[model samples]
Target: MNATDRLTELFMRFPGIGPKQAKRFVYFLLREHFHFKEQLINALQELKHTGKQCERCYSFFGDKNLKNPKSKCHICLNENRDEKILMIVEKELDLDAIEKTGSYNGQYFILGGVLPPLTEKPSELIRVRELVARIYDDITNDSLEEIIFALPVTDYGDVTKEYLEKTLGQIVGMKNIKMSTLARGLSSGLELEYVDRDTFKSALERRQ
Candidate 1:
């Protein structure tokens, strides 16, 4: 394939980008100024090196003066944020949406992805083991009290939540952690990343 075709193909790999949209992106980039392309390339190249994932919550942050290789993100390191409440989200975008609501002042764990039904060893698909470990660690060390499931309002989200509820319930001492999900303010099939802040806030407030 030529450069244009190869680039379009790569763009198509992005979530929700169809072949036509991907081609449009390629042509748009081709028409952009040389400096724009240079800047985009530079940013993409520096992304991995500049950003580091927090050891505690697994959220990525850009810290130029980071001293420790396993440093926590600002939210995890904050003294005021409630360590007892941990919210589990599917992706960083969902986390961003929740933060924008300004209703939740607690720690978060990004699952990286949602689990689909019939997937063998569902724990391997997302950060289930890591989340379990974190829950235990926080319960023992940080006085964890509750865990909120902030996944999208989709079939996969429900499946993942049910799996977590069942599995985590079996862990010793985890019974004390009050688990809840975002309320019905989120319509069926709605993703947390796309939900309005007001609706998200209402769901958060009504979470049981």
Candidate 2:
């Protein structure tokens, strides 16, 4: 394939992007100044170099000019954040939306993705084992009291949430840990990443 076709194909790989939109993006780039292309390439390269995943929460954060850049992200390093409450999310975008609300001040764990119904080995699809291990470690090492499932309201999200609740509840120490999810303020079929701040705040407040 030619440069234009190859670029469009690559852009189509992004979620929600179709062939027509990807083609538009490619043509838009072609019409832009050469310096703009250079800037975009530089930014993409810098993303990989500057981004670091927090060991504890597994959230990606940029450590641009910090003294100890290898350390955890700001949220995880903050002593004021509630270590006793852990919020589980489907992806980084969901975590970002929750943070934008400024309502939740607890630790977070990104499940990476939700489980698809057709997948035979559902546990292998997401970070299930890692999440369980983290919960166990937190209960033993930290003052973990609650685990909030902050997944989307979709069917797959519900499936993953139920699976986690069942599996985690079976753990000896997890019996006392309070488990909850976002309230019905989040309409069914709406993903957490697209939830408005007011709706997110209300759902968080009414989380059961």
Candidate 3:
């Protein structure tokens, strides 16, 4: 394959990007000046060198966020964050979007991915084991009071939520930990990756 075709294929691997979009991206890049192309290459190289997955929340953080002594991201190491509540989001981007709102002051967990309905191995689709472990540790510390489902409003998101609720219910039994979700402002097919501040705040405030 030519360089353009190879680049298009790589772009197609990005989530939600298809052939047409991938080709468009490659063409756009080809049209851009050499300086812009060099900048993109340098930026990607920097990301490769600096990116680090947060051990606690599984969010993608970088060196700047590693000032803490622990092998954790800045959010996980922040003492002022609410340890009593945890918001579980579908991916790193969703978590970042929530953080950008500056509305939530609680902890977070990135589920990695969502499960489709009736999947035989739901665990393979998300970080279920890690999630359980985190909850247990929280309970042991006597700080866990609630878990909020900040997943998307789509079918896959619904399936994942049901699975988490059923699986985690056993671990949370008699623990008095409240479980909630983003409320009112969300539309039926809303995706947390693109949630607006006002909409997210309303849903968070009205979460049952």
- Writing each residue's lDDT as its tens digit, candidate 1 over 1-208 gives 8999999999999999999999999999999999999999988877766788888788888776746665788898889998888899999998887787787899999998888987788877899899989888886785788889988777888899998888788653445778888787635555678777788778888899
> Using TM-score as the measure, what is the rank order of every candidate, best first?
3, 2, 1
**What are the RMSDs of all candidates, in order?**
2.3, 2.4, 2.4
Cα lDDT tens digits, model 2, 1-208, are 8999999999999999999999999999999999999999999888877778888788988888656746588998999998989999989988888888788899999999887666677678888888888888887776788888988777788888878887898773444888998787635555678778788888888999
State the lDDT of candidate 3 residue by residue for 39-93, as single tens digits.
9999898888778877889887676443555567889989999999999999888
- Shift in Å, residue 35, candidate 1: 2.7
- Clashing pairs in model 3? none
On a 0 to 100 scale, what is the lDDT of residue 103 in model 1? 74
**Candidate 1 positional error at 71, Å:** 3.8
What is the Å distance of residue 22 in model 2 from its true position?
Answer: 2.0
Among all candidates shown, the one with the greatest lDDT: 3
Instruction: Tell me how far the alpha carbon of residue 23 in candidate 1 is from the true structure, in angstroms, after superposition.
Output: 2.6
lDDT (CA) for every model shown? Answer: 0.84, 0.85, 0.88
Off by over 4 Å in 3: 64-70
